[model samples]
Target: MRSSFARSGLLTAGLCAAVALSTPALAQDKIKVGLILTLSGPAAALGQQARAAFEMALKDLGGKLGGREVELVVADDELKPDVAVTKVKGLIDRDKVDVVVGPTFSNILGAIAKPVTDAKVFLISPNAGPSPLAGKGCSPFFFATSYQNDQVHQVSGKVAQSRGYKTLYLLAPNYQAGKDAIAGVKRDYKGQIVEESYVPLNTLDFQSELAKIAAAKPDAVFTFMPGGMGVNLIKQYKQAGLADRIPLLSSFTVDESTLPAQGDAALGMFAGSNWAPDLDNPQNKAFVAAYVAQQKAVPATYAFQAYDAALLLDGALKATGGKTDDKEALRAAFLKADFTSLRGAFKFSRNGFPVQDFYLTKVGKRPDGKLETQIVEKVFSDYVDSYLPECSIK
Candidate 1:
């Protein structure tokens, strides 16, 4: 039931077709790394981009790492927690991969955590940093190369506090991620949460939700609806004529991938993220140029982070003289502060999360009719999660 790299979009046919065609000496073999993501249904586009960027990184790595072939196994978790567990199980039990990367959603990440740990394989999370793992829920085998979910929103909430918005309305999907986002916002902003509403995870129709937000009459509304849900919410927010009425503050709902699809509706929306295509860093400029040249498009934050993850992994492999199948050795190599990512200098927390900057972005349109995200403010510089004290790494 496990699909190979070709069908999974992590490798081309030439690679899979050649899997059996390798010389006998090739039996010295490659270390297999499995990637599980929600590659279909509502969040398909997010998973697709994550997988695409990841494969492109391997391709950029010339299909090999540490002198050994790198084989990627991808599974679709369909954005469901239960499905994620099943997919991880299949990858570990059937494919016996040495390392794992990605499931994208924080909820899904929580689902796959135990199985991957029980199997004794390292799980490298390029996205999805739930707060629990940063605290007492921390796992030795789990490493998040991306920021914790609270990092960006905590920044956004603090922005609200600085602006002195007294009354704020909050909305998010009734899921683990949504609750975490609300808690993150609350952690920083000491404002009147005039109202808070939890909508179903798949509620694409938001007129009802919009009404509650409107009636709350709050100075601002904070939300964390990523993927397709964002597209629907922005469109409805515009249609409801709420765009100019009440300020909209968000985390992960507006980005390169979502901006274009959102078009004029997203113009001037308040957002925050760790990386934007418009960041003024030299590494970001190079990453944006190279990414556009490769894909003929803007790279999403997820793509940039995943792209960085690959380079980080590459740095780890090379540091250890390209010998990485050894799990403990690989973990040590990975924990070393060794690489410059597209986000510039990168390092991990003692508990395996990012300590990085967060930016406040405004959704604006370029003169050429293409929508773009422009930085508007700063939340925190070189911020680490407050829950680090609860982690057991030290």
Candidate 2:
């Protein structure tokens, strides 16, 4: 009887040990997040800043979401759409990321939208919300933490019109975003366009465009060149001795990422966006402080958006209790837009694009004699995209 009782006690102890060993395996189930950014080439600065902020978000969130670990996978798109597509596919198939963030440029976003949506992977863009994605191509599984393509340009138009500029020369890259920028400016600026030029993508020479601007003799020049394009154009503009004579207004042309390289040339330049690094808000303050402490650099709009994207994903993960398989539930949770956004009072449009404030920022000298872009004024309060009418999302 004693031997039988001892065997029963041993078997019970073994069962308890088995359950204890299996519990950790259940706890080890993590939600995978895939981040695809243009981590190389001319846009490397934007991607690097984005990566920093995302890592910051992970750190702030204690590297977990809803008591579950989050596995983050990052990839570089090399500013190539084909490369972006392949990397996104690999993220979905191999990395098995439940959420996908970024491919900063609009061109890459366009290339990957179909595949990302078809795969039903939750795509939240840190930047690059092209018009089609915000309109006819709106997907339930996709959301944009950034504004629509034309948003900042529209704000620039408002700033230009407010400044009493009767005529403006507009320049942008020869791409979809370039066209959208021109269209956006026209929508807000009821002035004569003396000249409009779409320079070739990645064009280094702005002399020809500058000369044309000199001849057209517009009161001001508005441009939408981003990344290295903006750096090159701004330097040439300064070199041509046009910086002081003609005011430069832009969309994403002058920003934190490009401003240091621009030096004093960027000072006094006007650009517009939904976010600025010096925005006065609790969330913005916290994000900026953390970012500066970690990266030893000022955060840009791109960085803010990337950080917000991570927070947005975290909110959804929390809402669904970290279950990534129920995509519909996750999508619904994200649509609720429950996260604390750096862009104050943020919400999504019918098409999943951000409906938020737009501000005019002036590149000015900080107390430390460093060039920085600060918010001059708010242009649009809770602005909705013009393409929303085309979107049929209920």
Would you list the C-alpha lDDT of every candidate in the order shown? Answer: 0.81, 0.87
Candidate 2 structure quality by residue, lDDT tens digits, 71-130:
889999998889999999999988877778997889989988888889988888998878
State every prediction's TM-score relative to the real structure: 0.90, 0.93
- Model 1 misplaced regions, further than 4 Å: 1-25, 366-368
Q: Name the runs in model 2 displaced over 4 angstroms.
A: 1-28
Model 1 clash tally, residue pairs:
0
lDDT by residue for model 1 (2-72), tens: 57654676556667767767763374477688988778886676777778788888887898765568888
- Model 1 is weakest, by summed lDDT over 10 consecutive residues, at 19-28
**Candidate 1 residue 3 C-alpha distance from true site, Å:** 50
lDDT of 1 at 387: 82
